[model samples]
Target: MADASHTSYLPPILIFCAGAVIAVPLFRRLGQSAVLGYLAAGIAIGPSVLALVNDPDAIRGTAEIGVVLLLFLVGLELQPSRLYSMRKDILGAGLAQMALSATAIGLVGWKFGLSVGGAIAVGLALALSATSIALQVLEERGDGSETYGRRTFSILLFQDISIAPALALLPLLATTGAQNHSGAPALAGLGLALLAVALLVLVGRYLLNPFFRILASTGAKDVMTAAALLIVLGAAMLMERVGLSMAMGAFLAGVLLADSHFRHELEADIEPFRGVLLGLFFMAVGMSLDLQLVFDNALLLALAAPLLVAFKIVVAATILRVSCSSSTEAIRAGALLSPAGEFAFVLLPLGAALGLLNTQQAALATSLAALSMLIGPVAAKLIDLWLSRRAGPAETMEEDFEGAGGSVMVIGFGRFGQVVTQALLLQHIPVTIIDSNVERIRSASKFGFRIYYGDGTRLDVLRAAGAGKAKIICICIDNREAALRIVEMARAEFPSARLHVRAYDRVHAIELMKADVDFQMRETFESALGFGRVTLESLGLSYDEASLVIDSVRDRDAQRMEIQYHEGIAAGIQKVPRVSPEPLVQPKAKSKALTEETREVIEDGGAEVAVGGVGEPER
Candidate 1:
């Protein structure tokens, strides 16, 4: 017979999984975030509602490991070079926001009858935005590479790095924490914590790679995954034993391996565990909320949650605006990041332990954080409404590709795409053109062309437009990033279709080649070469001679690109012969010429010429 304790645990596990699976999708479908879903699910199953789980404490210890894993992943991504490159944004905007917000919030907390230490804890706790939720939302919207997205990420990253010192500060801030207990024991613990950090750095630098290599050679993926967890937990346990937060240790371990060869593999191995545990952490926090306390103080909380969100949004927007971001960008960052995050769950308890806050205060703060998180999605919706107004009717128009299918599917209907469609039409080949710009579609329709409204970066739109059946996919979008995304999606989802892309530049062309595209050409490459050939003809060369010059230049360029693709972009620079840096057409004289290209002044008649130079040619 199985142990009774073991059997009793099954129901809660089943309930937790079911709650997450159902609630997350439902919330997402409603245009809400997944973080909100997890919290609501926790509330439904906790004693506050269904009473399926009477004790949230049972899961809190386990859920905290999720944070440890989160920090590890964060550290893995912050390679030294990347960190250095982003130091300005991280330290400037990120650091400044944290300092200012904490100071502002701390003042408020202090004014409300809290002790100095309690105010400090509350200030820092509330100042942190949820890194997981904000980043996930940005990725979902496909804006992680945008300017505002990058700035948001930088601020969130700095918040994450702040966790270590914040955790360490809690104990010292406690009424009878480190200082009251200061003796041989405290000294020993401090020494041990330092020793643990040193040990972790040494193991990660000298031993971890070789250890993973052996595990890999055994050809058992499970063993490699097990090893990754061991390293994460081992470091965490060491830190916990030495009076430091587990998250601190895990972060150190990850930083050690950030530049290691196995960095990606470690991430791939740990991601599943990180994702599930992180979800579990949020749910656990939700379950821990004292719904009775919230009900009792409903009036206070009702005022506080929205006020907190509004203040945070105002603070964040102010900081971003000063950093030269546009109003839309500032508001978006403010709305998405204006929430007290997972750190509050950790810091509040620590604050309680250190006599900074009582149990009721801690619970109240937790309730406030949860309520603020709930308001975040609604705030995001409002920002969308605001941005849509500014986006103009042409671009903000909805996508409708009904009955839009053809043998050849073109992703964009801009200048390049319009010309490409004409050539395809010249061959009597039926083609379907899709673009996100409604105004462009209207203009094309007037020209006897039928272009549907769609975004190629979206797979569903591509499918609805009949890309699955099309023999070829032409990515002609002016946005290089969007075109690359389509190329990747086509390779994965429409493997049967040949991909031909309009590269934005040489770098874009190389990236397409690396993505294994069937054909790609720089948008201006051939046209520019043709123009130069005609230019040479006008300068006195025969057509054949001009063609030879163009051919030679094209050949040299192709060779340079080949070198760039095989080696590096800098390697291609060696192919260009060094020459004098003076204008070839203006050896020793200044000449008066057209500063601007002349356009027609009369219908079907050229503009009258004005020549003031000694070398002016006869008209």
Candidate 2:
């Protein structure tokens, strides 16, 4: 009987793994978020459906690890400098979002007959949005660097930070006779919490690094992996013992390691675990969702979920509208952040345990939160559709390009092309900007910038932009194949126009060079070089010395490109040579102060090392 009991537990594990393996890929192929797939899988196999898993508590206990690791990974990304750089967004936007959403939701709850404290706890919990869902959606849409993405992330970061306080406040809000505690005890608990946090920070700053260093020297991959898990688990245990959330401790540990040399290695070791565990956590949430309660209160559930989501959306959009310049961006932020977060699962239960919420109320809130998550991606899609409809007229306004002609024709006015156009315009140089993005063109016009809307790859658009008369044509589009095609067309037709192409990478650069464009720049090459120069300066090099080093490196790199170009041709690569244009800028005089070793390092494509003196070249 004991053997049979142990064997019966295996089915649930098998069912969960199999469900994830099948569901995630299917959802991804359908262009839906993988997170939805996990949730669906859980609901399908859970008690509400097939009831494949008999013991949800057992699975949930294990799934909690996922949340811990997820927080840790998030902490790793939040480097102190990066956080400081976005302080306005995090502290300002984040705080305002939490406060406003909580108060608004709290008032609504109070109207529904909840006690003030209970209402406030619920409001605070619902105020937070899902970080994992928002980030995954933004990344998939390739908008993580856009204005909306930044605003959404700032709000999410603040929500993550607020989790600790929210967890702490739940017990105080509880009015249960058994759970009553004095004000003095609460103050003592607060002090102990602060001390625990300080201890974590102190250990992370001084002790954790050396501990990992010793483990790293052992040079065993498994050993290192073990140590990484040990640290995370140890920190988690420490926090649990101190009456704080384990996830918070894990996040603090992650932040401490954010600047460490072993950060990438730690991330690699921990990523797979985090992914699987987080998936399990989502599934556990799905299993816990009582479908019978949802069915019984169908009308209430339907109304409550939408109302909650709409309230949050209004709060988020209003905040963005006040803080940002674009209405479309505000709308996007609202849609992206409307969903209830994973932490809601944690908060609702804690509320129930502390008697801040009865079991029935907690069940209602859980179903509502789950339903909101289901609506998140769909809301984002609808928002996109609305934006597209709003921008329809702007897309058809390309007739304005008929009279547009200049000495410089700039194609694809994205982030890169915008910079080039702004610089030229600032110098009082006449240029025509062309882009296919209707919204961008419309927005630029609002800012008093003249932008022509058209597809630059079409020859008609090029002719319309006066490519024949233009002395310089800058192709700053992101598509490598499209950039090459435009280069070929311009060479075939307007050979007199000097073509400058932006390459996505080294291979793209080689392709452009072979296509015989007059000039080619690897998109991020200069920016990376600039970053390296900044690093040298931070390490105590004078500005002039850093500048000299960058110049030397740049010259050597240019020479290498030239060699690669000829070598490819010699190796029977296709050639598309154009009439060579005159050099735009003369090279600066070479420095003669470098010793032989330094020159060898430069030529050999190695970094310069300071030997005896600070900022001095190596011997």
Candidate 3:
């Protein structure tokens, strides 16, 4: 009695899930991003084979959640204060890049026979490079917290913020016919945006942080996550109601909560959810892959995708070249940032509503956007290879290390690190700090701290810090990618030095643990929170009880986590061995015997389960 359509849809979900799990590991082994693997899987199991998801609307609706999470995280990173600090990059270079690219690309579109409004829309869309992919690639290459990363992030932030007004204007223009559109609605939308900003300023200045503090006092991680999500979704809804984009609202909310005590905690909680949702979203994009369209207009699609990406590269590079001196830096900036981002997807519906793009044109645009994103990783890889070849062996730069007398190297001199280094200095320790912040280094030099302008994660810089001679290397970088890069390099190059690191918090500590950073300290771990809570309780004469409670909870959780960590690592080792002197090849006899043993075990797996010398029912 069930509808035929309902049954037909289940297969695609199954295929997609199965394909994701299988392809991810294979690609991961090849040092490829899972996003590319997801795209490949979708193509392999798409409509041509299984015809899994035929309802475009339903698929898009589900995939849109991914967009929401993606933007939500983007917003979290774009604090107004952070923007203020990088005004030159954000306002000067970023604004120039957007304006120039939009003008250039608009002319190109106009030459292609599109109307003015359509040309403008296409131009704006082409100007946006994928922030998510760009950030990820930078992180992968250990440059995310570098000067390039900071500058690139500033430009991306401006583009995201500008998207709201652009989107709002699109619908109005389309409805009124771009040629005859009035500016009144655009002014109204601006007014609404101003109102939203005023309200956020009031709430952020008065309520948001205080509200978060009260929530943190409860020591509930789930509550914090829920509150964070509520803020993002609530702001997004408000923006949508005012004919602005949800991304803008979400970003505004993030900026408002940027300086909160719970900011890092909230980010940690939301990151995994955001990552998985983004993967699903990208996979859904893969599902929407129309091979037929590509085959039909293969030449057009091919030429359009790369041409658009190249155009973006040229504009972004030219702007950055003016800002930076080195040709290597400029080319790296351009090569790393030559693809359309999630904003293109956001712009598509707006373009359609604005009458700038008809249905076919919009679909084609979306397809190009997706294609550009898919190939972006490969483009970045090629650029990195070119840079590597041109720069020669990175090891040859060892001469830069001469004159280093410090016994210790401090990677960052942020607030947490400042305190630690001050304490070390009080004991007359010879410590040299490596940091990339020009202003911070200037200020520190005036204050008479031993700080150098450099990226701590780069092997060359670490060597310049006399990493081999240092007795200890303290990595207190706030950014996660930089922290991991330092850990990786230290593990490979200076294995003898004691490594002490400051993690953002508990979850970041977990990730650092996976990277073999055994000595990790959470920058603001639960110890401080728990101590504060207990001390407050002690003021009421419940000191012993509070101390006992905190101690018991900490000890038990630590023990259980340690057990689980080791167990999981052991299980993983059983499956995939780490690098060894010998080839990781399995013997035929051993493989056959293991396969037979696994099958036998599966067949006889009925009665009971065991854990740590305890037996239990299998169920």
Candidate 4:
């Protein structure tokens, strides 16, 4: 009884979703980027291949919204204060990148026999890098807070901001007088664009926060989410109606809300939508690729794509090297940002409309850009390998730490790790620490701590941090999954090293215990127990009496935890009768087959006493 028109729309959605579900996980498992997988999925199900989605235009329209939301989220992450702090980099490096890359590409286009206007259009389109892809890649590598990432983001921000003016300028490049409007109209259009932006900012600053607060007070999360969507879509629509990029408008709105009290709430509401749509956006890019054109001009497409990427990489690397003073950072910035961006689709069409590019030229440009993006990750990997080799084995953490063996290896140098490191240092005990966060490592170094940079879950990184020589390996990372992984890796690779893991909760503690970890401290257990002791003392109990009571409770809890570890709770509880008179204590004598490390820590403390795990490891 459903309308046939409505039912017909289901197949494409199903095909797209099915492709994503199948391809993303497989590609991730193969150690490839998920964006690449989404693109491959789109190509597989597209008209050129399976013909599952015959009309690419319809999907493109929907996918464009994804780009808008992506920009909006980027704006949300970039607070005004942060943007201001990086203004020098944004203006200096970002401007230089655009000017230099555009000029170079424009000359290339002119050499290929295009008009000056056409060459300029092509250059501008190719100068920008894919913001979505670059950000996603940075996030995957956990480098979003690193200096290279910040520099990359500064350039991308300038590109996004430039899109509006770029679109406006395209029409003026037309040779035909009818299409080419006079300077007055162009100025008027610029004024209108500015007004629209000002209006968005004003409304967002004054009206949006209060509106969201009211919606949030209703205690309906779905309603709050709906309001957030309404704000984005409404701003996008407003911008489109006024002849501006929807993404630009959405970004303005996002910036306005970035410093609001409800920023996190709004972000949480919008994330799922952004992710799904962004996936679809990448898939749409894949579907839009003209396979026949690529096949017919395979050699030209291949050469053009790599040439564009190469030129951009060199320009970016040189700029970063001059500014940052580090070749590794420079190479990373260049390689990661070499791809032609999503804006090329917008710019190329505008160029065609303004008589700068013919249909054939536009198609060629589009194909070349897509190919460049497809090879982006591979290019980045090659650059990283090259840089690492150039830096030499002596510069690596493994080599640096080889002569500085320590008794303790701290897996994370965050707040928790910092505390442990300080404590050991105060006692004149040697300690080696590693953290994956580049920013944290740099900050710790300023404080005179010699923390290394590497992921501890990798056995190789662990070995580099002197895990083999360490008597104790402390797993102090705050992330539950990461903590679990470190525990597993440490236990397997360094069976001789005792692992002291920080668990997030009772469930986490149980999981760590199940892994046969030498020690597992629930993050808040000792803190809560300490608070209880303070309350008892305040209530007039003697210090000795309070201590006895706390110790008794702690002992009983440990016994319960141990019981729950080997047997299910029901079975463990059944082992203890209600008629029992004696206190429950883990037998002091060695059990039948206790692990040597576990027995040692327990014997040394008289109980498995550990400090609170509530705060971050110190850096």
User: Which pairs clash in model 3?
Assistant: 174-354
Task: Compose the digit string of candidate 1's lDDT tens values, residues 1-619.
Answer: 4799789889988988998998999988988878889889888888888888877567676468767877788787777755765788899889988998889888988898788888898899988888877877886665675778878888988998898888877766663444546556545666777787888888788988898788889999889778777887888888888889888888887887776666655665666576577678777767877789999999999998899888888888888999899998998988878888778878888899878988877788878887887787678767866786788542445667777778899989888898889989999987989887767888778978888876677667788899888998999988776686678668867889988889887767776777678888877777766776678679865555555455555555666667666686444333332111121122232223312321122222221122112473211
Q: In candidate 2, which residue pairs clash?
A: none
Total backbone collisions, model 1: 0
Whose lDDT is higher: candidate 3's or candidate 4's? 4
Query: Whose lDDT is greatest here?
Result: 2
TM-score per prediction, in order, is 0.68, 0.64, 0.63, 0.65
lDDT value, residue 573 of candidate 2 = 52
Give the higher-TM-score candidate: 1 or 3. Answer: 1
Residue 5 miss distance in model 1 (angstroms): 3.3
| lDDT per model vs. reference | 0.76, 0.77, 0.70, 0.76
* Window of ten residues with lowest summed lDDT in model 1: 577-586
**Model 1: residue 312 alpha-carbon error in angstroms:** 1.1
Candidate number achieving the greatest TM-score relative to the actual structure:
1
Per residue, candidate 4 scores C-alpha lDDT tens digits across 1-619 of 4799899889888988999999999988977778888989988887788878878577668567777877788778667645776798889888999999999998998999888888888999999899988888886776665688878888888887777678777766663334445667656767887788888888887888799889878999889777767878888888877777787677777777776667665765676576688898888888888898999999888888888889889999899899863888888998888999888877887788777888999888888888888888778867766776887642323224555468988878877678778889999898888787666777778989887777665555677778888999899988775676567556656789988888887767766666677777766666666776677669865555455555655776677666766577433332222111222232244235534653453446533343324464411
Clashing pairs in 4: 414-617, 415-616, 415-617, 415-618, 416-616, 416-617, 416-618, 417-617, 418-618
Ranking by TM-score: 1, 4, 2, 3
Steric overlap count per candidate:
0, 0, 1, 9
